[model samples]
Target: MSTNARQQLQHHLRNARYEVLPLRGTLEQVQGLPPGTTVTVTSSPSKGTEATLDLAARLRGSGMHVVPHLAARLVRDSAHLDELLSRIEALGLTEVFVIAGDADNPAGRFTDALSLLRGMEEIGNRPHRVGITGYPEPHSFISDQMTIQATDEKARYADYIVSQICYDPNTIASWVKTMRARGVTLPVYIGAPGSIDPSKLLRISMKIGLGQSMRFLRKQHGVVGKLLTRYTPENLFDELSPYLVNPDYNIAGCHLFTFNEIAKTRQWAMETADRLQEVPA
Candidate 1:
């Protein structure tokens, strides 16, 4: 890539977040990030939001700008939402990512991200910035039309979008175009799978019902091959550079789903950051 393009891409990388599962050793691995790098904690259905909050607080105390996923379905009511916000506030956290969560059943009144965002606004608990989810590939359960409409509505309340895992750069570019055409113009943080065991990634994608995306990955290898047994975002980032450098797209950065494989992922991030710095503007 040209130096200008590489530099532009680096600009986005500077603000990207290293997304991780709120599991053992999360804090230690996240310490690898340079100061000012954001760390996003995922909300696990098995562990609930408590783990996310705990990790977020720890990271914040350690000087990282932390963003914890506030799973709307896990929250019980308005009071619960208030308390969560209060705790986040006490820690001086000003950003959050809201999601509908993985729960098959809603825990209370808020069924989706938009509902929770509205609830926060109603209770005067709006964080400085809020993020919402987006899907570049068609959602397995929701219609494309519905996804578009819901995304359009959510854009009103959200400051940015962190897309669901997507491997196909063309598909992502097209989806960004679609979002722009439909006026869902929130700053977009492209979601890419972190360097991970391909088998584990396949299982997680399948469990989340991202069968269509999985099929796309399979087709790239020509049939159901083991070529996806190990994966990296390097190629995806190369494929996405055009859009990433294009100012009109308002593409903010990447949100890496590290799957808690932080050591390897941190190495990759550091190497890439070094390259970004070496390139002349």
Candidate 2:
């Protein structure tokens, strides 16, 4: 790798944020993160919004910058938004990620991220930084045009974006180019899975409807089998170095989906950082 590219890789890795689901062993895994590391909690249909908030509160108490996922579909109303903001502030959190969520039906008025974002702005207790999601591939339910429009609208309220998991760097690069052309200039944190067992990875992928990406990987035979053995983010990160280093992309850093395997991910990141440092600049 070129010295400039290597250095950019190090910079992006050092600033990467980690996202974790609220489940058993989450606290212990979170406790393993470096002090002041940014940890975003994911909201689940089974666990609900309260669980996400509780996990964020606990993580904040442990000294991490906790950004809880605020699922718009899960929120009850404007007053509910106010209460959620109050709870997050009381925990000293000033960042949040908004998603449309996976709920089969809306629990309240807000059904999408744009509505929730606008509602938050209207309430006057906005977080210091707000994040919204981006999809490089076409969404299963929403049209490509709708996704673009929603992102453009949400960008008004958001400070940055975390893209959904995409296996192809070429696709990601193209998506970034298109986004820049459309004038959505928020800094993007590319989403990638952390170290995870292959079976678990496959199950998670299936659960989230990432069938196309999974099928592509499966055809590569070795990649899918190796994922079962031990899957790391090395190859993906290396492929992304060009986009990260190039000034035009505005690819801020990584947003790792750790899958609660915090210790392994932490080790991998540290080791990779060390490797990057050794590359002569």
**Model 2 agreement with the true structure over 187-276: per-residue lDDT tens digits:** 999999888767888777766666456665676555666654655687778887878878789988888888888787778888898999
What TM-score does structure 1 among the candidates reach?
Answer: 0.93
**Which candidate's lDDT is highest?**
2
TM-scores of the candidates are 0.93, 0.94
Model 2 scores a C-alpha lDDT of 0.86
In model 1, the worst 10-residue window by lDDT is 222-231
Runs off by more than 4 Å, candidate 1: 276-281
Q: Ten-residue segment with the worst summed lDDT in candidate 2?
A: 221-230
Model 2 steric clash pairs: none
* Residues 134-183, model 1: lDDT tens digits: 99888888898988888998889889999898778888899999889877
lDDT of every model, 2 decimals: 0.84, 0.86
